[model samples]
Target: MHNDALCNFWTSTLGERPPARPRLTAHLQADVAIVGAGFTGLWTAYYLKRLSPALNIVVLEAERVGHGASGRNGGWVVGNLAGLERHIGGLSLDERRLCCGVVADNVDELGGVLAREGIDADFHKGGAIYAAARYRDQVAIQRGYLQHLHDLGHRETDCCWLDAGQLAEKARFRDGYGGIYHRQVATVNPARLVTGLAECAERLGVTIHEHSRAEILERRKVSTGEGSVEAPTIVCATEGYADGFHDFKRHVLPVQSLVVATEPLSESVWQEIGMAERPAFSDASRLINYGHRTADGRIVFGARGSYRLGARSKADQAIGEAAMRMRRDLLVDLLPALEGVRITHGWGGSLGLSRNFRPHAILDRRHGLATAGGYAGEGVAASHLFGRTLADMILERDTELARMPWAFADASHRQLIKRWEIEPLRWLAAQAITFSYAGEEALMRRGKPLPLIKPALQRMNDYFASVIE
Candidate 1:
C-alpha cells in the first residue's frame, strides 16, 4: 500500500504539459479582468468572448489553468441545485422548473459545445442513480425522495424509482434495497473539459496569464504578486480559494471532498458491477458518497471528508492514510467484488460552500465586481450557466438567463443569519454530525428503527431555515 498522496489522477492522466505562459509582470488594462483560471473564470471568459468578440478579456491564475477544484471534482453535471427548494421556496413552480431546466440544458449545451469545438473530453449523458444500501437510505428514498419528486411536479418517469433487481441492471450494491434515478445528469473528464474551455477562450482572443496570483481585488482593479490589471469590470471567480481575500471570507466556506480511483478492472468484474451506460451513482447517505464508471474502465468513488478547523484552509494535502483507507473500504462495501482491486489514485480538493447552500451569481455594477460560485459539490454544469448569466448581465443582454433567481447583485442581508458559529463550536458541530451519521449507518445495518439523530439534524436544519427567513 504505497501512499501516493500528492498527485491528482485527472492531471496525471493528461501526462506531460507544455510550459506555463509568462506570468503577468507589467501592468495591463482590459475590458474585463478575471481572477482564477479554473472553470468559473474560464467559462466566464469563453462566454464573454463569444458574446462580444471584440471585448478585451484577461484571466489571471494563481497557478496553471484547471489547477483547482475544476480539475479534481467528481465530474457529475447534475441539474439539481445545492440547496434544493429550501433556498428557492419563493419561486413559483413554473419558475423553479425553468430554473432547473436551464441548469439541465447547460449540461447538454456543454456536450454540444465540446463536440462543436472538437474537444474530446469523453462526455457522457449517462444520468445518475442513488442506491438504497441501508435502512436510512431506504427510508430516505421510499419516504422522503418520492414525495420530493412529486412536490417538484416531476413525472414518474422523470425520476423513476427502481427496485433492487432493476438497480442490479445498472450496478450492484451489497445492501441494495431500492432507489431513484434521474436522467438529466452527465459525466465528463473534468480536467479535460476545463483545459479545453481555457483553450477555446484563448483562441477567442482572451489573454491568460499562468502563475499570476491575484493578491488583492478592488473596484475595477486586481493587484497580483507580479503585476496589476485595471479594467472597467473585474470578476472574482476564485471559488474555494476565496478565503485568503478578506472581502469574500463571510460569503463562502471551503469544504474538502476526497476521491479514490481503482486500477483498471477486467470485463468480468465490470459485468458483475454493471454500469454499462456509465451512470454516476451514490448511496442515499446524508454524508454524500458519489461514484461513476470511467471511460478507461475505472471505478472512481468519493465522499466529503473531514474539514479544516480554521476558516482559511488552503490546498492542504487530503489523502491521509486513514482517509484513503476509509474511502477504499467504502468502495468495497458498495461493491463486494472489488475487495482486491488496487487503488491507483487517492486525492481530494476543496469546494466552495455558501451560507444558503445554493450557488450564487451576482454582478454588482456599483462595485464593478461580478462573482459566481458556491456550488457546494455540484459545480460542473452550474458554472457554465452561471458564467453565461454573468456575461449576459455584463453585456446588458436582456435574456431569460439573466432573470434567474440568483442573478441579483447583493446578498448581504440574506447572508446575515447564515453567519455560522465561530471555530471550535462549528468544528464540534461538524464532527458531531459526522459521528452521528456513522452511528446511524451502523444501526441501519441491523435493521434497527430510525434514531434520534435524524430528527435532531432536521430540527437544526429547520432552525437555521427559520432564522434565515
Candidate 2:
C-alpha cells in the first residue's frame, strides 16, 4: 500500500517527470556555486548576480528543475511558521516584529522578482486563508492569535477573519468553524515559478546544470560522482532529498508529505462551492490537513504524511494506504458532502526539517563551503527569504540581515543510527498519532469535548507544508 501510494502521488499529481540532467563530469571553478536548483539554489544564484554581475555563479540540480518540494508543493507561498503565534511570549516586541516583518516581506519580494523578470508563474497576491476546522479550533485561534495579529499591527486588507458558516461556502470549502485571512500571501504554479527562475537566472548569465547532483563536499570544493566543483563559496539547497551529505541525517528530518489534486472544477461548480476568500486553509489538529484552490480551480492538498520523530524519513518513501485513508477521511470532515469528488493526482515529497521551525543556510565560513537545509515545512516564502539572505552572506563577508538564529547555528552533523532502529520507530510514532488524531477529529465533529491534549495539538500535523514536507 505504501509503495503504491508513493509511486502514484510522486509521479502523477506532481506533474511531468523531470528531464534527465547530465551529471557533473569535469572539475570546474567559479566564484560561487549553488547545490540544489530549487528556490533556494536559484534564488541564491539570482541574488548573488544581482549584487555583483561580474562574479561567476553556477547552480547544479540533481533532477530536472523543481523536481524537489518546490515543484511538488501545492503552490502556497507563505512567510510565517505555523504555530509561531503561540511562541511569542519569549520574544521581545521588537524581535517579534522583525520576525513578522521578514515573513510579511517574503511574498512581496517574490512578487517583485517575478514581475521584474516577467515570469508568469500564475502569481496571485490576493491573500490566503488559515482556517479552523472545528468549533474548538475556532475558539482557540480567536482567543489567542487574534490578539497577536492586533499586537503586530500587521493587519492588511487581505488579512482578517471569517466564521464557520462563511467557511462552508468557500470555493471547495466543505466545513469549518472559521478562518483567518492572511494578506500578503499568494499562490503560484510552483513548477512554472521554478522553471521561470531557472530561465531568469540563466538570462542573467548564471549557468545552471540540470541532472547534476553533488555528492561530496571538501573544505571549499564539492565533488559530484561525475565531476568536482571548486568555488569560493557553495550553498546546499536540497530540501528533503539532501541525504547526499554526512551531516544531513542529524541536522534535518526528511519528511514524506502526500498531496492530491482534484480535476479542474467546472466554472459553475467553482462559483457555487468556492469562497470569495482565496487563501489556503489548515485546521487545528494534532495532524493538520491543508489545501488551496489554484487559479485554474483544481484543489491541491497535503498534510503530515511524514513523521520521523526518532527515525529517518526519506522522499522516495511511500505514504501508504492507511495514511491516505486518514487524509481522505479528514478531508471529508472538513468538507463533508464531497465524498464523491475524485482525487486525480496523488503524491508526496520530503522536506528537510530542522528541529527549529526556520529555514537555514549553514556555512563553513572560513572554508568557503556552506550548507543550508531544514525548512521544517515552511519553505515557500522562507526558502526565498533564506536564499536571498544566504546570498548576501556569501557575496559580502557578512550580511546586514542579523546572524542566523541560534537554532540554525549548528554545524551540520550526520545522525547516529543503525539501519534497523530509527526508521521503524518513526513509522510507529506516526501511525499512533494518525490513529489518535483521527479519532479525536471524529469526536470533535460530534460536538464531544476534546480530550485534554487534543485542542493543544490541533495543529500538529501542520508540520506538513513546512519546507521539508
Give the top-scoring candidate (lDDT): 1
- Candidate 1 segments exceeding 4 Å error: 1-6, 136-139, 153-156, 316-318, 410-418, 450-469
Q: Could you tell me which 10 consecutive residues in candidate 2 have the lowest summed lDDT?
A: 412-421
Per-residue lDDT of candidate 2, residues 171-206 (tens digit): 344545676767777877777888888889888999
C-alpha TM-scores of all predictions: 0.93, 0.82
lDDT of 2 at 223: 79
Point to the candidate with the largest TM-score: 1
RMSD of each: 2.7, 4.9
Clashes of each: 0, 31
lDDT, each prediction: 0.79, 0.66
lDDT of 1: 0.79
